[model samples]
Target: MQRPDDVRWPVRVARAVLHAQATGTLIAQYGLVERAWPAALPAVPATRLGVQANCLTDVGVRGMDEAAVFLAEHLKLQGLPEAGEPVERLSAGGWAARHAAGEHSDADFCAVIDAQACFAGAWATARELVSAVLESGGPPRSPGALLYAAVVAGGEANPPVPAAELFALAGKAAAREADALLVDLRLAAYTLKRLSHPPGALGRLAGLVRGTGDAERRHALSPADAATVRALAMNLEALALLKKAAAAVRTLEDNLAENRAGHPESVGETLSIAAYFHYREQDLTRALELIAEAYRLVRRDGAPDRLRGCRKIAVAALHCGGRTAEAEQVQLRMARDPLGFDEEIR
Candidate 1:
């Protein structure tokens, strides 16, 4: 929001998540999410803070805000750093809307500080407790947000923090937290593997893409998870981790195909990511197709800013495809928006 520069921490967190989810277009005007983190994060696929916030929110609701309360109390007790004044946590309905669907009854809601030592920097203790969470699970949900938090908090590295610890943390989380939207698991694993062992990660992603052809899973990723794919792919692309990025983009595209029936936002967002990847590869034909598809989705969804951004991309793609007059017409359309800011582009 506000051009990214003017935003504060949580909103900054939100912006980062949105950019990761599918560039700045998906949540350009609204449809943002922030989960509690070091403070919190908005609901965009690429946001670790959102995962963390959502994690705490999930565990809390599973136990009726008990887990979340303990986290706050644990932070206070350990004097772990936090920002902003403490605010009341959301109710279960609110959490369910943000996280995966759950059916935790009132009895499931209780405060348990058993992970206090784990959360408070007792490494062995924390790791063991996390293992217990993995072992003692019912249905899939993101229960590893706190562990991810601990790993991030513990690692302070100009020389790069010991990645083994991160691997251990993410590895465990990824196993049990199969909730698609709880992308903290995959994000952490991808970041770690992408940075340290690119080839292996690439292979793993390729397999994941191949595996999506199966019937049970069917590549039906929630919009949030797909955005996470987009975000991580962007990161990999930036690092010149081309193979891994390609795999991620493929996964994202497949996800879009499976779930595009009723969700225009996902369609528009993933199309943008796909279009950018194609544009980078100089596949102007596919890129223009993607841009046009995304523009239609954005307009159908009634998002002016998103439509404006889509038109901009169309102009670029049209110019690159040697269709200069078409690009000019798209530019003229931008000038006609209510804001009139695009008039200056002329």
Candidate 2:
């Protein structure tokens, strides 16, 4: 089948590879290669090599004849002198070695490393790469690299630099890259993590969330305003402001109702957040109602990880509502199908 020309296809493939790496499942990794490899064959050299390198690193060439064939084809396309060598004998590390020998662009290398760091929990390497990139930079070289740096710096363990400074740096990159919404969301998340019970911190997070919502409305983007609102509500809950948190959740629900068509995943996530808030408030009935809706949406249209999360919430609500047997059944289903592919719960 002929694949459509999509300039962003390489990035999507890279993300799938990263997700496979995070899941650490051979099924996920093989599924990505089978689906993405053919489509990516027609991409540009840099993109193709980047995607190939990421796949090879995450899923070794062992037992995968298709991977070997594609590697040879990609090398030939790139005019690499060693194209005829038996790829079956080459380890995944060999691909990295080739890239390090100047076959791939620095951007691709950094991007792959950033993916590993971001998704695969290679934080030490990510911190090092980000520091090197920033120290040698003129302007923000990569928005994603900077964002990863900010996330690493904001983590609980001792940061390489102050989280605030890294976040500010990331903000600059976001402005240049036109990714302000993502930066705002990260900043809001950081605030929630760092602040214990300060009203001022919560107020700042609310402002960030509000600003993100305004920007989304102006651009007619997918109404991720619900997510920001939900984050703000979570911070309110952290501060023991239950009523205010409930109000924020209501706003989240309203946003979902208003823009349900743009992104079903976001709607599902917003509903799940609301259910958790209701669960915390001891409104088990309401919590179950919201979570059931979320489960149905995610089961039909969301990723396995999302379905798993929604199921967890359902279990919590059921267990708290004195339905221990039903909760156990759900728990058993969850354990049996970690991917959340089972039929709908009764």
Candidate 3:
């Protein structure tokens, strides 16, 4: 089918391919994609579209022939290409066949459509991941890793492709996909905390509080999970509030004493929170100080996760604070996982 004008399927396709790896659990976790399809695509199913609606259900996940039929019909309606012709056929094999037979004379059109299918597949994968992570129950694996997997898959799926010259070839997609992407990020943060408790738990709590405005469901957790849920929520609020107060001191410089007093901490987390604030404000010096204090406190307390988190903040603070030499040295010994870079980490 011809892509929508506003969708930009080329980019979407790239992102989808990158995110497909994490889709299985994401789909099972989330249960369903927030808003699956647009109103215009009546032919597309919310729960099932024969085999074409791979994102909705596993109705035809294994039937490529059925998928081809749907594609052929979609192509016929769009009038962009057809099944037997190189431009019209719907399979990876068909694409090869057309290319080999010289039936697809327009290389540009062939490239665009193939890219769209690949992206659609990736998007399907992400949706699947979201659904999986949110599901009520599953294996005992940490939720954080699943979430990280989703982000990793997502970033990998949509690697930037320089296609400014081929603007017309970009197939547009529904805004729902972008919305879905953000939701996935939020979910990733929640899952990450699940992987590692207390601090990771704290981060997840913070996310829930900050993300309340954008939550898809009013009641995401069950009544039985109340204690855990409250812990997650409160932890996020505390961290976020502490971070904000610290930022006020650095940026406004007027709120330092006031924020610090309100965010009193006997443990070293207060310092870490301060560092978080300064880092956001770009006040690397102050951030480094707080991070150091936090690291010391965490080490004494014997909470490796919190300690590791503080160390990470310290490294980043040093790097941004113009202590490039120190930051480089610190980076060499750190765990250095890319999962930390996921948008949800914000």
- The numbered model that scores best in TM-score is 2
User: In candidate 1, what are the lDDT values of residues 1-346, reduced to their tens digit?
Assistant: 0111111223233233334444332322122222222223322233442112222222111112222332332223232223333433343233333233344321121111122221111223223333333333431233345434334323222113333353344445555323432333343344443345555544544444333323124556544555544444333333335445566456556756744754443456668667776676677888788877776555543334455667777788889889999899888877555222242222
Please give the lDDT score at residue 12 for candidate 2: 41
Q: What is the clash count of model 2?
A: 0
Tell me the lDDT of model 3 at 330.
58
List the candidate 3 regions with Cα displacement exceeding 4 Å: 1-235, 238-266, 333-346
lDDT of each: 0.41, 0.49, 0.36
TM-score, every prediction: 0.39, 0.58, 0.27
- Tens-place lDDT digits, model 2, residues 1-346: 0113222223344444434445553243223343343322322133432223332221110111233233223323332222121212222243244444545444554454433332233344444444444444322345554555566556543465565666666677664322554465455555555533346555765765566666666764445545544443443334334446667556555655644655453566667767877787788888888888887766553234556677788898898889999999888887665434566753
Error of 2 at 193 (Å): 2.4
Q: Which has the better TM-score: candidate 1, or candidate 2?
A: 2
Q: Give the top-scoring candidate (lDDT).
A: 2
Regions more than 4 Å wrong, model 1: 1-142, 147-164, 170-189, 192-198, 206-255, 261-266, 280-285, 295-313, 325-346
Kindly report which residue pairs in candidate 2 clash with one another: none
Quote the positional error of residue 152 for candidate 2 in Å.
3.7
Q: Lowest summed lDDT over 10 consecutive residues: which window, candidate 1? A: 106-115
